[model samples]
Target: MPEDLPIGRRERLLAALRSRGSVRVRELAAELGVSLPTVRRDLALLADRGLISREHGGASARTSAPERRTDGPRWVVGMVLPSLHYYFPTVAQGVKAVADAAGAKIVLRGSDYDPVVDREQIGLLVARSEIDGLIVAPELRHPQAPEMLRWLDALPLPVVLVERQPPSDFFIEQLQWVASDHRRGGETAVEHLLAQGHRRVGIFGTDNVTGMQVADGWRQALRRHGIDPDEQLMGRTGLFQRDARISAFGDVVERVRKGTLTALIVQPDPDAIALAQRCLEAGLRIPEDLAIVAYDDEIASMGDPALTAIRPAKAQVGRLAMEVLLHRLRLGHDAAPQQLLVRPQLIPRQSSLG
Candidate 1:
């Protein structure tokens, strides 16, 4: 019998046995540059721990008791947004569908567009150990994003961002997210306006990440047409304070005076309808005075003039977001992050043209 070996030596011996199936005491001694007695003692400890089997003056791989592997706890998904209204519900639908297929449950937490609330929700999830993973559409951008990511990373769980890009120009590029191609959506929206013979197309949207991206898309489309993206024609004032209604009203009033704004692409349909109603009250006619196109056809349909809008597959986005999350959860934290972009469709209606 050999004397007790150090923890490191025991580990090395176990690893060798696991890899090579079995090892003679002499061979283990020679491989680890230790005495035969020391190798035998190390093997004995491992065998006692049921990590190996000692026999024939040597050791073999542990085959009697298999190492346990668990799927961890049931997955808990976190969502940070204003509500389960028009867009969020669609995304939730997709997430839920995929989660069901993957044998996971979701814990949706609406932050009501508050970062503090989002932070608190994350703390709750971590403290409770209720969630194994997170798919968040952050209320704010990068510095805030890194904070959330760092916290989740420490817990050694998977976290995926859905339908948002980080705000601060910092490490947002490094994070993973699933979102629609708003730039292309903007281009498509503007192109639709142009096709209807309106050159001076105005765009309206919120100051959030999705809104900014759509605004950029609109500008890029205008630049592609050799039209300079004029700041005056753009209406997003402050990134935080600008809502769809306020921005739409500002755009309507500002452009109406300049008289260069002919057609418009409003990211939210409600805003477009509000502007149209304002215009109507001001004695301006739709398609005659100003042709408007809005995004999210479902929301746009509520107004008097059924809006021509860019309709991304709402249910599909939700379903696909869930699919992405499920795939991430299955792969675990060691897996590489993935980014998915859903395409958009343009729905023609009476607001833009007859």
Candidate 2:
């Protein structure tokens, strides 16, 4: 923490910077529960103390801000992501590693899955005069996503999206991103189950971008085997409704017992692990009664039988995102934007193979 500064705001600000790498002034204002001017004053003091580096729109950890190179002006980058939890921490770690190596300053902020927050954070970064480029994982679930895309396209700085892939029908040229190809992840699960001679496979997961892509791949893989994909076999639900989730879990267990469903692919670790527990309660033998392949390898092995799962290269995505942004910073904005996808690896455990 910065020495001799006010306890609450300075400590919190430093903590945010360490977790986020960088931050916008408005974001800090909101986080500190202080007014904009107060935040600006605190930032100025911190900068003077050499506790932080004041950049274009916000302040960053002093170490993360690019040093005076004598070769050129300092390069500042703005990054906004959805959340700091779950799948994104590794992503941020990767981004920080690359940025530190390149001697570029990175200002990072979290949008908390709110579309309004996304706009506000990005606007703050863009408002800064020194921000050379941007890396964003926007809230694509918003109703006005297209308008947001247009706005991002109009920004002067080069922009690279981390984990977000806008629909191809939307202007891919306007907003290029690097993301995990979750659709292919789903296909890999189905192919593995098919190879094991499981004919009736089901899918279960929350209704979200990743889940939708995995389902698309699951259906396509089934078609390649000359079988019509069963919509009835697809389960859509979220964790918010506990009774509903459990009821659906019971239904899936019944299906397995009756030999109507021979295997299942479930996305995200929590839901898959929950389903495994439910199956055990229903006296179903894993792989013997039914096999399971889970998407998102996080904690998948914690299940009683351990789960076969798809592991996305999350840190690599972060590393590649910064690399892509660095490439854009060197080349002018006139250069073509790059869109890339990283494939997830399918990990086998006792849940599916045993």
Task: Please provide, for model 2 over 40-114, each residue's C-alpha lDDT reduced to its tens digit, 9 standing for 90 to 100.
Answer: 887786676445678988987643222345654356788998878878888888988888898877888998888
Model 2 deviation from native, Cα RMSD in Å: 9.6
> Each prediction's Cα lDDT score?
0.67, 0.78
Residue-level lDDT tens digits of model 1 in 1-354: 433445346546645764577889998889889888777777676565444677988978644312222564255565555566657788788778877766677777787667777767655553332455567776765357666554433332345667764444534322466778777888899888888887788776878776888888888888888887784366653321235333345546567667888887776766676777777777777877788888777678766677788987766766766666566656543446676777788988888884
Best by TM-score: 2
- Report RMSD for candidate 1: 10.7
Model 1, stretches more than 4 Å misplaced? 1-76, 152-155, 166-175, 236-259, 333-335
Q: What is the Cα-based TM-score of model 2?
A: 0.76
Residue 83 in model 2: shift from native, Å?
A: 1.9
List the RMSD of every prediction in angstroms.
Answer: 10.7, 9.6
